[model samples]
Target: MRLPPLKALPVFEAVARTLSFSAAAEELHVTQSAVSHQIRQLEDDLGESLFERGGRRVALTEQGERYLEAIAPALAQIERASEQLRGVTDSRIRLAVPSSFAVSWLIPRLPHLQRQHPELDLDLEMLADMPLMSERLADCFITFRYRQRGYSSERLYVERLFAVCSRQYWNRVRDELDEAGLRKRGSGVTIRPEWLTRFTLLSAASVFERPGEDWRRWFAAGEAKLPADAHVQHFSHMLLAHEAARHHQGIALSNDYMLDTASDPDLIKLPTHELQTGDEFHFACKTARRNEPGIRHLSQWLVKQAEASGWKV
Candidate 1:
Protein backbone atom coordinates (compact mmCIF):
# COMPACT_ATOMS: atom_id res chain seq x y z
CA MET A 1 0.00 0.00 0.00
CA ARG A 2 1.27 3.47 -0.92
CA LEU A 3 1.31 5.87 2.01
CA PRO A 4 2.16 9.55 2.51
CA PRO A 5 4.75 10.75 5.03
CA LEU A 6 2.91 10.15 8.33
CA LYS A 7 4.99 12.57 10.42
CA ALA A 8 4.68 15.38 7.87
CA LEU A 9 0.88 15.05 7.86
CA PRO A 10 0.56 16.37 11.46
CA VAL A 11 2.91 19.29 10.69
CA PHE A 12 0.80 20.19 7.67
CA GLU A 13 -2.45 20.02 9.70
CA ALA A 14 -1.05 22.21 12.48
CA VAL A 15 0.25 24.82 10.03
CA ALA A 16 -2.96 24.83 8.02
CA ARG A 17 -5.09 25.07 11.17
CA THR A 18 -3.30 28.10 12.71
CA LEU A 19 -2.13 29.78 9.46
CA SER A 20 1.00 30.73 11.41
CA PHE A 21 4.25 28.81 11.48
CA SER A 22 5.18 30.08 14.93
CA ALA A 23 1.74 29.23 16.29
CA ALA A 24 1.82 25.77 14.71
CA ALA A 25 5.32 25.24 16.10
CA GLU A 26 4.20 26.19 19.58
CA GLU A 27 1.13 23.92 19.36
CA LEU A 28 3.24 20.95 18.26
CA HIS A 29 5.95 21.76 20.81
CA VAL A 30 8.60 21.96 18.10
CA THR A 31 10.93 24.62 16.70
CA GLN A 32 9.70 26.99 13.96
CA SER A 33 12.49 25.87 11.62
CA ALA A 34 11.50 22.26 12.25
CA VAL A 35 7.91 23.10 11.22
CA SER A 36 9.16 24.77 8.01
CA HIS A 37 11.33 21.79 7.16
CA GLN A 38 8.52 19.30 7.70
CA ILE A 39 6.19 21.39 5.55
CA ARG A 40 8.80 21.46 2.78
CA GLN A 41 9.24 17.72 2.99
CA LEU A 42 5.45 17.19 2.90
CA GLU A 43 5.08 19.43 -0.14
CA ASP A 44 7.90 17.57 -1.90
CA ASP A 45 6.24 14.25 -1.21
CA LEU A 46 2.78 15.41 -2.38
CA GLY A 47 4.05 17.44 -5.38
CA GLU A 48 1.53 20.13 -4.43
CA SER A 49 1.94 23.42 -2.62
CA LEU A 50 -0.33 23.44 0.43
CA PHE A 51 0.18 26.97 1.70
CA GLU A 52 0.47 30.49 0.40
CA ARG A 53 3.34 32.07 2.32
CA GLY A 54 3.65 35.84 2.17
CA GLY A 55 6.10 37.57 4.49
CA ARG A 56 4.96 36.62 8.02
CA ARG A 57 1.37 35.76 7.06
CA VAL A 58 0.42 32.23 5.99
CA ALA A 59 -2.82 30.91 4.49
CA LEU A 60 -3.82 27.45 3.37
CA THR A 61 -3.95 26.95 -0.36
CA GLU A 62 -7.17 25.33 -1.67
CA GLN A 63 -5.39 22.00 -1.75
CA GLY A 64 -4.23 22.40 1.82
CA GLU A 65 -7.73 23.17 3.13
CA ARG A 66 -9.10 20.08 1.43
CA TYR A 67 -6.23 17.97 2.76
CA LEU A 68 -6.80 19.24 6.27
CA GLU A 69 -10.50 18.38 6.06
CA ALA A 70 -9.60 14.88 4.95
CA ILE A 71 -7.24 14.33 7.90
CA ALA A 72 -8.69 16.29 10.82
CA PRO A 73 -11.50 13.84 11.65
CA ALA A 74 -9.11 10.92 11.41
CA LEU A 75 -6.75 12.67 13.77
CA ALA A 76 -9.51 13.44 16.22
CA GLN A 77 -10.71 9.82 16.17
CA ILE A 78 -7.20 8.55 16.80
CA GLU A 79 -6.79 10.96 19.70
CA ARG A 80 -10.09 9.82 21.16
CA ALA A 81 -9.21 6.16 20.87
CA SER A 82 -5.80 6.75 22.45
CA GLU A 83 -7.42 8.64 25.31
CA GLN A 84 -9.89 5.83 25.88
CA LEU A 85 -7.07 3.29 26.01
CA ARG A 86 -5.36 5.42 28.64
CA GLY A 87 -8.55 5.31 30.78
CA VAL A 88 -9.54 8.83 29.84
CA THR A 89 -13.26 9.40 29.42
CA ASP A 90 -13.26 12.26 26.98
CA SER A 91 -16.79 13.76 26.96
CA ARG A 92 -15.65 17.36 26.79
CA ILE A 93 -16.92 19.37 23.85
CA ARG A 94 -15.05 22.56 23.07
CA LEU A 95 -17.13 25.50 21.87
CA ALA A 96 -15.72 28.74 20.53
CA VAL A 97 -17.92 31.82 20.92
CA PRO A 98 -17.71 35.57 20.66
CA SER A 99 -16.68 37.09 24.01
CA SER A 100 -19.74 39.27 24.45
CA PHE A 101 -22.10 36.42 23.63
CA ALA A 102 -20.32 34.26 26.17
CA VAL A 103 -20.78 36.81 28.91
CA SER A 104 -24.18 38.31 28.12
CA TRP A 105 -26.02 35.32 26.69
CA LEU A 106 -24.42 31.89 26.93
CA ILE A 107 -22.78 32.05 30.34
CA PRO A 108 -26.00 32.98 32.13
CA ARG A 109 -27.87 30.03 30.62
CA LEU A 110 -25.07 27.51 31.30
CA PRO A 111 -26.93 25.84 34.13
CA HIS A 112 -29.61 24.78 31.67
CA LEU A 113 -26.95 23.27 29.46
CA GLN A 114 -25.61 21.32 32.41
CA ARG A 115 -29.06 20.07 33.37
CA GLN A 116 -29.86 19.06 29.81
CA HIS A 117 -26.61 17.30 29.09
CA PRO A 118 -25.21 15.92 32.30
CA GLU A 119 -23.04 13.30 30.60
CA LEU A 120 -21.04 15.87 28.65
CA ASP A 121 -18.67 18.59 29.79
CA LEU A 122 -18.09 21.85 27.97
CA ASP A 123 -14.98 23.95 27.49
CA LEU A 124 -15.55 27.44 26.17
CA GLU A 125 -12.95 29.51 24.36
CA MET A 126 -14.32 33.01 24.22
CA LEU A 127 -12.76 35.10 21.47
CA ALA A 128 -13.28 38.60 20.16
CA ASP A 129 -13.17 37.22 16.61
CA MET A 130 -14.09 33.64 15.86
CA PRO A 131 -11.80 31.62 13.62
CA LEU A 132 -13.12 30.55 10.20
CA MET A 133 -12.71 26.82 10.63
CA SER A 134 -13.89 24.45 13.39
CA GLU A 135 -10.94 22.09 12.74
CA ARG A 136 -8.25 24.32 14.20
CA LEU A 137 -9.48 25.95 17.36
CA ALA A 138 -12.46 24.14 18.86
CA ASP A 139 -15.02 21.45 18.02
CA CYS A 140 -17.77 23.95 17.25
CA PHE A 141 -17.98 27.69 16.65
CA ILE A 142 -20.62 30.41 16.79
CA THR A 143 -19.71 32.83 14.01
CA PHE A 144 -20.76 34.73 10.93
CA ARG A 145 -22.08 32.75 7.99
CA TYR A 146 -19.63 32.01 5.21
CA ARG A 147 -19.43 29.00 2.93
CA GLN A 148 -16.90 26.47 4.12
CA ARG A 149 -16.91 23.50 1.72
CA GLY A 150 -16.55 20.62 4.18
CA TYR A 151 -18.39 22.14 7.10
CA SER A 152 -22.06 22.11 8.07
CA SER A 153 -23.45 25.51 9.07
CA GLU A 154 -26.85 26.58 10.40
CA ARG A 155 -28.05 30.11 10.97
CA LEU A 156 -28.51 30.55 14.68
CA TYR A 157 -29.28 34.22 15.39
CA VAL A 158 -29.22 37.78 14.06
CA GLU A 159 -28.59 41.07 15.79
CA ARG A 160 -31.31 43.58 16.72
CA LEU A 161 -29.24 46.54 17.76
CA PHE A 162 -30.33 49.68 19.58
CA ALA A 163 -28.82 52.28 21.87
CA VAL A 164 -29.12 51.70 25.62
CA CYS A 165 -27.92 53.21 28.86
CA SER A 166 -28.38 52.90 32.59
CA ARG A 167 -31.80 53.95 33.91
CA GLN A 168 -30.06 56.02 36.58
CA TYR A 169 -27.85 57.74 33.99
CA TRP A 170 -30.85 58.52 31.82
CA ASN A 171 -32.68 60.00 34.82
CA ARG A 172 -29.96 62.65 35.05
CA VAL A 173 -29.40 62.96 31.28
CA ARG A 174 -33.15 63.30 30.69
CA ASP A 175 -33.36 66.51 32.74
CA GLU A 176 -30.19 67.83 31.07
CA LEU A 177 -31.61 67.08 27.61
CA ASP A 178 -34.97 68.56 28.66
CA GLU A 179 -33.16 71.73 29.72
CA ALA A 180 -31.54 71.91 26.27
CA GLY A 181 -34.90 71.22 24.53
CA LEU A 182 -33.39 67.98 23.13
CA ARG A 183 -35.94 65.75 24.90
CA LYS A 184 -38.93 65.36 22.59
CA ARG A 185 -41.36 62.65 23.58
CA GLY A 186 -43.99 62.19 20.93
CA SER A 187 -45.57 58.76 20.30
CA GLY A 188 -43.35 56.04 21.84
CA VAL A 189 -39.90 57.49 22.51
CA THR A 190 -38.22 59.27 19.65
CA ILE A 191 -35.02 61.32 19.50
CA ARG A 192 -33.06 63.07 16.77
CA PRO A 193 -29.99 61.07 15.81
CA GLU A 194 -27.78 64.10 16.15
CA TRP A 195 -29.02 64.47 19.74
CA LEU A 196 -27.08 61.33 20.71
CA THR A 197 -23.86 63.32 20.35
CA ARG A 198 -24.71 65.29 23.51
CA PHE A 199 -23.76 62.33 25.70
CA THR A 200 -20.68 60.09 25.57
CA LEU A 201 -20.93 57.25 23.01
CA LEU A 202 -19.69 53.93 24.32
CA SER A 203 -18.14 52.09 21.37
CA ALA A 204 -17.61 48.37 21.40
CA ALA A 205 -14.75 47.52 19.09
CA SER A 206 -16.51 44.40 17.77
CA VAL A 207 -19.73 46.27 17.07
CA PHE A 208 -18.94 49.98 16.63
CA GLU A 209 -15.90 48.79 14.67
CA ARG A 210 -12.85 50.69 13.38
CA PRO A 211 -13.62 54.01 11.67
CA GLY A 212 -17.13 53.66 13.13
CA GLU A 213 -18.61 51.73 10.20
CA ASP A 214 -21.41 49.96 12.10
CA TRP A 215 -22.17 53.18 13.96
CA ARG A 216 -22.44 54.94 10.62
CA ARG A 217 -24.84 52.26 9.41
CA TRP A 218 -27.01 52.68 12.48
CA PHE A 219 -27.13 56.47 12.04
CA ALA A 220 -27.93 56.08 8.35
CA ALA A 221 -30.74 53.66 9.21
CA GLY A 222 -32.20 56.23 11.59
CA GLU A 223 -31.85 58.93 8.90
CA ALA A 224 -29.85 61.03 11.32
CA LYS A 225 -26.45 62.47 10.63
CA LEU A 226 -23.65 60.98 12.71
CA PRO A 227 -21.72 63.82 14.34
CA ALA A 228 -18.32 64.50 12.79
CA ASP A 229 -16.79 64.82 16.27
CA ALA A 230 -18.96 62.77 18.57
CA HIS A 231 -17.35 62.17 21.96
CA VAL A 232 -16.65 58.43 22.01
CA GLN A 233 -15.16 55.99 24.50
CA HIS A 234 -13.98 52.62 23.20
CA PHE A 235 -14.23 49.22 24.83
CA SER A 236 -12.51 46.13 23.49
CA HIS A 237 -15.71 44.06 23.78
CA MET A 238 -19.47 44.60 23.90
CA LEU A 239 -19.87 43.33 27.49
CA LEU A 240 -17.43 45.97 28.70
CA ALA A 241 -19.39 48.62 26.85
CA HIS A 242 -22.57 47.36 28.48
CA GLU A 243 -20.93 47.38 31.88
CA ALA A 244 -19.76 50.91 31.29
CA ALA A 245 -23.26 51.93 30.27
CA ARG A 246 -24.67 50.21 33.37
CA HIS A 247 -22.37 52.38 35.51
CA HIS A 248 -23.56 55.66 33.88
CA GLN A 249 -20.41 55.99 31.79
CA GLY A 250 -22.14 56.27 28.40
CA ILE A 251 -24.74 54.92 26.00
CA ALA A 252 -23.93 51.42 24.72
CA LEU A 253 -25.28 49.60 21.71
CA SER A 254 -27.05 46.37 22.66
CA ASN A 255 -28.55 43.39 20.85
CA ASP A 256 -31.65 41.28 21.62
CA TYR A 257 -29.64 38.20 22.59
CA MET A 258 -27.72 40.19 25.19
CA LEU A 259 -30.53 42.21 26.70
CA ASP A 260 -33.91 41.42 28.21
CA THR A 261 -35.48 44.78 28.98
CA ALA A 262 -38.26 43.18 30.98
CA SER A 263 -35.76 41.65 33.40
CA ASP A 264 -32.99 44.21 33.38
CA PRO A 265 -34.08 47.04 35.69
CA ASP A 266 -30.76 48.81 35.21
CA LEU A 267 -31.06 49.59 31.48
CA ILE A 268 -33.43 51.65 29.32
CA LYS A 269 -33.53 51.72 25.55
CA LEU A 270 -33.05 54.70 23.24
CA PRO A 271 -36.17 53.30 21.50
CA THR A 272 -37.29 53.70 17.86
CA HIS A 273 -33.70 53.72 16.54
CA GLU A 274 -33.26 49.96 16.39
CA LEU A 275 -31.12 48.68 13.53
CA GLN A 276 -31.05 45.08 12.44
CA THR A 277 -27.56 44.93 10.94
CA GLY A 278 -28.52 41.85 8.83
CA ASP A 279 -25.51 40.06 10.28
CA GLU A 280 -26.36 36.35 10.66
CA PHE A 281 -24.71 34.31 13.42
CA HIS A 282 -24.23 30.64 12.60
CA PHE A 283 -23.38 27.39 14.36
CA ALA A 284 -20.74 25.50 12.39
CA CYS A 285 -18.94 22.18 12.64
CA LYS A 286 -17.21 19.67 10.41
CA THR A 287 -19.77 18.10 8.05
CA ALA A 288 -18.30 14.67 8.65
CA ARG A 289 -19.06 14.84 12.34
CA ARG A 290 -22.28 16.83 12.20
CA ASN A 291 -24.35 13.91 13.39
CA GLU A 292 -22.13 12.98 16.32
CA PRO A 293 -24.32 12.73 19.40
CA GLY A 294 -22.40 15.24 21.49
CA ILE A 295 -22.13 17.84 18.72
CA ARG A 296 -25.75 17.47 17.66
CA HIS A 297 -27.00 17.74 21.23
CA LEU A 298 -25.08 20.95 21.83
CA SER A 299 -26.15 22.54 18.53
CA GLN A 300 -29.84 21.81 19.10
CA TRP A 301 -29.68 23.05 22.66
CA LEU A 302 -28.04 26.24 21.52
CA VAL A 303 -30.72 26.83 18.89
CA LYS A 304 -33.48 26.16 21.40
CA GLN A 305 -31.92 28.59 23.86
CA ALA A 306 -31.61 31.27 21.20
CA GLU A 307 -35.20 30.80 20.10
CA ALA A 308 -36.35 31.02 23.70
CA SER A 309 -34.39 34.27 24.01
CA GLY A 310 -36.22 35.83 21.00
CA TRP A 311 -33.59 35.09 18.36
CA LYS A 312 -35.20 34.85 14.94
CA VAL A 313 -33.49 31.71 13.66
Candidate 2:
Protein backbone atom coordinates (compact mmCIF):
# COMPACT_ATOMS: atom_id res chain seq x y z
CA MET A 1 0.00 0.00 0.00
CA ARG A 2 1.09 3.58 -0.66
CA LEU A 3 2.43 5.47 2.41
CA PRO A 4 0.38 8.38 3.69
CA PRO A 5 2.08 11.42 5.22
CA LEU A 6 4.25 10.40 8.25
CA LYS A 7 2.33 12.79 10.50
CA ALA A 8 -0.95 11.05 9.76
CA LEU A 9 0.00 7.67 11.36
CA PRO A 10 -0.50 8.92 14.96
CA VAL A 11 -3.83 10.54 14.06
CA PHE A 12 -5.11 7.38 12.34
CA GLU A 13 -3.92 5.07 15.12
CA ALA A 14 -5.50 7.19 17.89
CA VAL A 15 -8.87 7.44 16.08
CA ALA A 16 -8.91 3.72 15.24
CA ARG A 17 -8.13 2.69 18.85
CA THR A 18 -10.50 5.20 20.47
CA LEU A 19 -13.15 4.43 17.83
CA SER A 20 -14.26 8.08 18.00
CA PHE A 21 -12.77 10.96 16.03
CA SER A 22 -13.73 13.45 18.82
CA ALA A 23 -12.00 11.37 21.50
CA ALA A 24 -8.85 11.02 19.32
CA ALA A 25 -8.86 14.78 18.59
CA GLU A 26 -9.16 15.57 22.34
CA GLU A 27 -6.24 13.28 23.20
CA LEU A 28 -4.09 14.64 20.34
CA HIS A 29 -4.99 18.34 20.95
CA VAL A 30 -6.43 18.70 17.42
CA THR A 31 -9.85 19.45 15.99
CA GLN A 32 -12.26 16.52 15.49
CA SER A 33 -12.53 17.42 11.77
CA ALA A 34 -8.71 17.36 11.42
CA VAL A 35 -8.55 13.91 13.04
CA SER A 36 -11.32 12.66 10.75
CA HIS A 37 -9.52 14.15 7.75
CA GLN A 38 -6.24 12.34 8.61
CA ILE A 39 -8.03 9.01 9.11
CA ARG A 40 -9.85 9.45 5.80
CA GLN A 41 -6.52 10.13 4.05
CA LEU A 42 -5.01 7.00 5.64
CA GLU A 43 -8.01 4.84 4.73
CA ASP A 44 -8.00 6.21 1.15
CA ASP A 45 -4.30 5.41 0.75
CA LEU A 46 -4.77 1.84 2.01
CA GLY A 47 -8.13 1.42 0.10
CA GLU A 48 -9.94 -0.04 3.15
CA SER A 49 -12.74 1.06 5.45
CA LEU A 50 -10.96 0.53 8.80
CA PHE A 51 -14.02 1.32 11.01
CA GLU A 52 -17.83 0.88 10.97
CA ARG A 53 -20.02 3.74 12.20
CA GLY A 54 -22.51 2.81 14.96
CA GLY A 55 -24.93 4.91 17.10
CA ARG A 56 -22.66 7.84 18.16
CA ARG A 57 -19.65 5.52 18.25
CA VAL A 58 -17.39 3.40 15.97
CA ALA A 59 -16.01 -0.18 15.84
CA LEU A 60 -12.80 -1.38 14.12
CA THR A 61 -13.09 -3.91 11.29
CA GLU A 62 -10.70 -6.94 11.01
CA GLN A 63 -8.24 -4.96 8.85
CA GLY A 64 -8.30 -2.07 11.36
CA GLU A 65 -7.36 -4.41 14.28
CA ARG A 66 -4.46 -5.90 12.25
CA TYR A 67 -3.18 -2.46 11.24
CA LEU A 68 -3.36 -1.15 14.80
CA GLU A 69 -1.36 -4.14 16.10
CA ALA A 70 1.43 -3.55 13.53
CA ILE A 71 1.56 0.25 13.94
CA ALA A 72 1.63 0.10 17.78
CA PRO A 73 4.82 -1.92 17.80
CA ALA A 74 6.40 0.20 15.06
CA LEU A 75 5.69 3.38 17.02
CA ALA A 76 7.08 1.84 20.22
CA GLN A 77 10.28 0.79 18.45
CA ILE A 78 10.74 4.32 17.07
CA GLU A 79 10.37 5.82 20.55
CA ARG A 80 12.98 3.42 21.94
CA ALA A 81 15.44 4.19 19.16
CA SER A 82 15.01 7.91 19.72
CA GLU A 83 15.80 7.55 23.44
CA GLN A 84 18.92 5.45 22.75
CA LEU A 85 20.29 7.95 20.26
CA ARG A 86 19.61 10.81 22.65
CA GLY A 87 21.62 9.04 25.36
CA VAL A 88 24.60 8.55 23.08
CA THR A 89 24.45 12.12 21.83
CA ASP A 90 24.60 13.33 25.43
CA SER A 91 27.37 10.97 26.55
CA ARG A 92 30.81 12.27 27.58
CA ILE A 93 34.15 10.72 26.71
CA ARG A 94 34.54 8.12 29.44
CA LEU A 95 38.02 7.39 30.83
CA ALA A 96 39.09 4.70 33.28
CA VAL A 97 42.23 5.22 35.41
CA PRO A 98 43.81 3.95 38.60
CA SER A 99 42.95 5.81 41.84
CA SER A 100 46.52 6.80 42.69
CA PHE A 101 47.18 8.04 39.20
CA ALA A 102 43.90 9.97 39.15
CA VAL A 103 44.59 11.74 42.45
CA SER A 104 48.29 12.40 41.97
CA TRP A 105 49.17 12.79 38.32
CA LEU A 106 45.98 13.16 36.28
CA ILE A 107 44.23 15.58 38.65
CA PRO A 108 47.07 18.07 38.37
CA ARG A 109 47.45 17.56 34.63
CA LEU A 110 43.76 17.75 33.65
CA PRO A 111 43.59 21.54 33.87
CA HIS A 112 46.55 21.79 31.51
CA LEU A 113 44.95 19.40 29.04
CA GLN A 114 41.70 21.33 29.28
CA ARG A 115 43.45 24.67 28.70
CA GLN A 116 45.24 23.25 25.69
CA HIS A 117 42.20 21.55 24.20
CA PRO A 118 38.95 23.14 25.26
CA GLU A 119 36.97 20.97 22.88
CA LEU A 120 38.30 17.75 24.30
CA ASP A 121 35.55 16.77 26.72
CA LEU A 122 36.41 13.99 29.13
CA ASP A 123 35.17 12.01 32.14
CA LEU A 124 37.70 10.43 34.48
CA GLU A 125 36.61 7.24 36.24
CA MET A 126 38.73 5.61 38.94
CA LEU A 127 38.84 1.83 38.79
CA ALA A 128 40.41 0.84 42.11
CA ASP A 129 38.18 -2.15 42.75
CA MET A 130 38.23 -3.57 39.25
CA PRO A 131 40.98 -5.96 38.15
CA LEU A 132 41.13 -5.12 34.43
CA MET A 133 39.55 -2.43 32.28
CA SER A 134 36.36 -3.90 30.96
CA GLU A 135 36.89 -3.37 27.23
CA ARG A 136 33.20 -3.36 26.39
CA LEU A 137 32.51 -0.54 28.88
CA ALA A 138 35.34 1.97 28.68
CA ASP A 139 36.20 4.30 25.80
CA CYS A 140 39.76 4.95 26.97
CA PHE A 141 41.77 3.33 29.78
CA ILE A 142 44.99 4.25 31.61
CA THR A 143 46.72 1.41 33.41
CA PHE A 144 50.22 0.18 34.27
CA ARG A 145 51.01 -2.81 32.09
CA TYR A 146 54.21 -4.12 30.59
CA ARG A 147 52.65 -5.18 27.33
CA GLN A 148 49.77 -3.97 25.14
CA ARG A 149 48.57 -6.95 23.13
CA GLY A 150 45.05 -7.69 21.80
CA TYR A 151 44.17 -3.99 21.63
CA SER A 152 45.06 -0.76 19.83
CA SER A 153 47.23 1.03 22.38
CA GLU A 154 49.79 3.76 23.03
CA ARG A 155 52.39 3.88 25.81
CA LEU A 156 51.98 6.99 27.97
CA TYR A 157 54.72 6.78 30.59
CA VAL A 158 57.35 4.59 32.20
CA GLU A 159 57.11 5.39 35.94
CA ARG A 160 59.84 4.64 38.49
CA LEU A 161 58.59 3.07 41.73
CA PHE A 162 60.18 4.15 45.05
CA ALA A 163 60.07 3.12 48.73
CA VAL A 164 58.56 5.76 51.02
CA CYS A 165 58.66 5.74 54.83
CA SER A 166 57.74 8.24 57.51
CA ARG A 167 60.40 10.65 58.82
CA GLN A 168 59.79 9.35 62.36
CA TYR A 169 60.78 5.87 61.19
CA TRP A 170 64.03 7.23 59.69
CA ASN A 171 64.84 9.00 62.96
CA ARG A 172 64.32 5.75 64.87
CA VAL A 173 66.86 4.09 62.59
CA ARG A 174 69.41 6.85 63.33
CA ASP A 175 68.88 6.42 67.09
CA GLU A 176 69.29 2.64 66.86
CA LEU A 177 72.56 2.97 64.90
CA ASP A 178 74.05 5.46 67.44
CA GLU A 179 73.34 3.00 70.24
CA ALA A 180 74.75 0.07 68.21
CA GLY A 181 78.10 1.94 67.61
CA LEU A 182 77.66 1.52 63.81
CA ARG A 183 77.36 5.28 63.29
CA LYS A 184 80.65 5.41 61.36
CA ARG A 185 80.91 1.80 60.23
CA GLY A 186 78.58 2.02 57.16
CA SER A 187 77.13 4.45 54.64
CA GLY A 188 73.93 6.24 55.75
CA VAL A 189 71.98 3.96 53.44
CA THR A 190 68.76 2.87 55.23
CA ILE A 191 68.89 -0.62 53.78
CA ARG A 192 66.51 -2.60 55.98
CA PRO A 193 68.92 -2.94 58.99
CA GLU A 194 69.15 -6.73 59.05
CA TRP A 195 68.87 -9.19 56.18
CA LEU A 196 65.89 -10.89 57.90
CA THR A 197 64.78 -8.84 60.96
CA ARG A 198 64.78 -5.08 60.38
CA PHE A 199 61.48 -3.44 59.47
CA THR A 200 58.07 -4.25 58.05
CA LEU A 201 57.88 -4.84 54.26
CA LEU A 202 54.85 -3.67 52.29
CA SER A 203 54.31 -4.61 48.62
CA ALA A 204 51.58 -3.91 46.10
CA ALA A 205 50.37 -6.46 43.56
CA SER A 206 52.46 -7.06 40.44
CA VAL A 207 51.39 -5.54 37.16
CA PHE A 208 51.51 -8.98 35.52
CA GLU A 209 51.13 -11.96 37.92
CA ARG A 210 50.06 -12.73 41.48
CA PRO A 211 53.67 -12.37 42.72
CA GLY A 212 54.15 -9.21 40.67
CA GLU A 213 56.09 -7.53 43.44
CA ASP A 214 56.94 -3.96 42.50
CA TRP A 215 59.12 -3.71 45.61
CA ARG A 216 61.04 -6.95 45.06
CA ARG A 217 61.76 -5.96 41.47
CA TRP A 218 62.96 -2.52 42.58
CA PHE A 219 65.05 -4.03 45.39
CA ALA A 220 66.49 -6.67 43.08
CA ALA A 221 67.69 -3.96 40.69
CA GLY A 222 69.44 -2.32 43.66
CA GLU A 223 70.93 -5.69 44.79
CA ALA A 224 69.19 -5.29 48.13
CA LYS A 225 66.53 -6.85 50.34
CA LEU A 226 64.65 -5.83 53.46
CA PRO A 227 66.60 -6.84 56.59
CA ALA A 228 63.92 -8.62 58.58
CA ASP A 229 60.74 -10.68 58.44
CA ALA A 230 59.18 -7.26 57.98
CA HIS A 231 55.45 -7.60 58.53
CA VAL A 232 54.61 -7.86 54.86
CA GLN A 233 51.33 -6.17 54.00
CA HIS A 234 49.72 -6.46 50.60
CA PHE A 235 46.91 -4.13 49.56
CA SER A 236 45.02 -3.89 46.30
CA HIS A 237 44.67 -0.12 46.48
CA MET A 238 47.86 1.94 46.17
CA LEU A 239 46.17 4.92 47.84
CA LEU A 240 45.23 2.86 50.87
CA ALA A 241 48.75 1.52 51.11
CA HIS A 242 50.11 5.06 50.99
CA GLU A 243 47.70 6.12 53.72
CA ALA A 244 48.88 3.19 55.85
CA ALA A 245 52.43 4.39 55.28
CA ARG A 246 51.52 7.95 56.22
CA HIS A 247 50.28 6.78 59.64
CA HIS A 248 53.74 5.20 60.22
CA GLN A 249 51.99 1.88 59.84
CA GLY A 250 54.51 0.42 57.37
CA ILE A 251 56.79 1.16 54.43
CA ALA A 252 54.66 1.36 51.26
CA LEU A 253 55.87 0.33 47.82
CA SER A 254 54.93 3.48 45.92
CA ASN A 255 55.81 5.01 42.60
CA ASP A 256 57.34 8.48 42.41
CA TYR A 257 54.28 9.91 40.67
CA MET A 258 51.99 8.36 43.28
CA LEU A 259 53.84 10.29 46.05
CA ASP A 260 52.77 13.64 44.60
CA THR A 261 50.39 14.14 47.51
CA ALA A 262 52.67 12.97 50.34
CA SER A 263 54.81 15.53 52.17
CA ASP A 264 58.44 15.61 50.98
CA PRO A 265 59.73 14.35 54.35
CA ASP A 266 57.00 11.72 54.78
CA LEU A 267 58.38 9.26 52.20
CA ILE A 268 62.10 8.45 51.62
CA LYS A 269 63.65 6.45 48.82
CA LEU A 270 66.00 3.63 49.66
CA PRO A 271 69.51 4.07 48.18
CA THR A 272 68.14 7.28 46.60
CA HIS A 273 67.73 5.87 43.07
CA GLU A 274 64.80 5.54 40.77
CA LEU A 275 63.51 1.93 40.72
CA GLN A 276 63.28 0.50 37.21
CA THR A 277 60.35 -1.67 36.28
CA GLY A 278 58.97 -3.16 33.06
CA ASP A 279 55.56 -1.75 33.91
CA GLU A 280 54.48 1.41 32.07
CA PHE A 281 51.25 3.40 31.65
CA HIS A 282 49.33 2.66 28.47
CA PHE A 283 46.09 4.00 26.95
CA ALA A 284 44.18 1.33 25.13
CA CYS A 285 41.22 1.70 22.77
CA LYS A 286 39.20 -0.93 20.99
CA THR A 287 41.12 -2.30 18.02
CA ALA A 288 38.22 -1.44 15.72
CA ARG A 289 38.15 2.27 16.71
CA ARG A 290 41.90 2.97 16.52
CA ASN A 291 41.54 4.77 13.21
CA GLU A 292 38.78 7.10 14.44
CA PRO A 293 39.98 10.70 14.67
CA GLY A 294 38.77 11.45 18.23
CA ILE A 295 40.34 8.25 19.58
CA ARG A 296 43.63 8.95 17.80
CA HIS A 297 43.68 12.55 19.05
CA LEU A 298 43.17 11.40 22.65
CA SER A 299 45.86 8.71 22.39
CA GLN A 300 48.44 11.15 20.97
CA TRP A 301 47.53 13.94 23.43
CA LEU A 302 48.07 11.59 26.41
CA VAL A 303 51.54 10.65 25.10
CA LYS A 304 52.44 14.29 24.48
CA GLN A 305 51.30 15.28 27.97
CA ALA A 306 53.39 12.55 29.58
CA GLU A 307 56.43 13.73 27.70
CA ALA A 308 55.79 17.34 28.68
CA SER A 309 55.57 16.20 32.32
CA GLY A 310 59.13 14.71 32.01
CA TRP A 311 57.85 11.14 32.03
CA LYS A 312 59.37 8.61 29.64
CA VAL A 313 56.63 7.70 27.13
Judging by TM-score against the true structure, name the best candidate: 1
Give the per-residue lDDT of model 1 (tens digit) for 166-285: 988887767676778765633345776777888888887777467466567778888986788888887777788889999999888889877888789999887557888878888888
Q: Candidate 1 overall Cα lDDT vs. reference?
A: 0.81
> Could you give candidate 2's per-residue lDDT for residues 1-313 as a string of tens digits?
6466678888867776556889789989999889878888888888898888787778888898777756754664465468567774423457888777889778887887678767667888787543333332356688764243435678877777766767676566556666676565446754543431355656666333343366666556667764334467777667767777777776776775676533455666554445767677788865655675666777778888677666765
Model 2 residue 244 distance off true place after TM-score fit, in angstroms: 1.5
The lowest-lDDT stretch of 10 consecutive residues in candidate 2 is 129-138
Deviating ranges (above 4 Å) for candidate 2? 1-91, 129-135, 145-150, 178-197, 205-219, 224-228, 261-265, 272-275, 291-293
Itemize residue pairs with steric clashes in candidate 2: 194-227, 195-227, 196-227, 196-228, 197-227, 197-228, 198-228, 206-212
Q: Report the Cα lDDT for residue 120, model 2.
A: 68
RMSD to truth, every model: 2.3, 16.7
lDDT of each: 0.81, 0.66
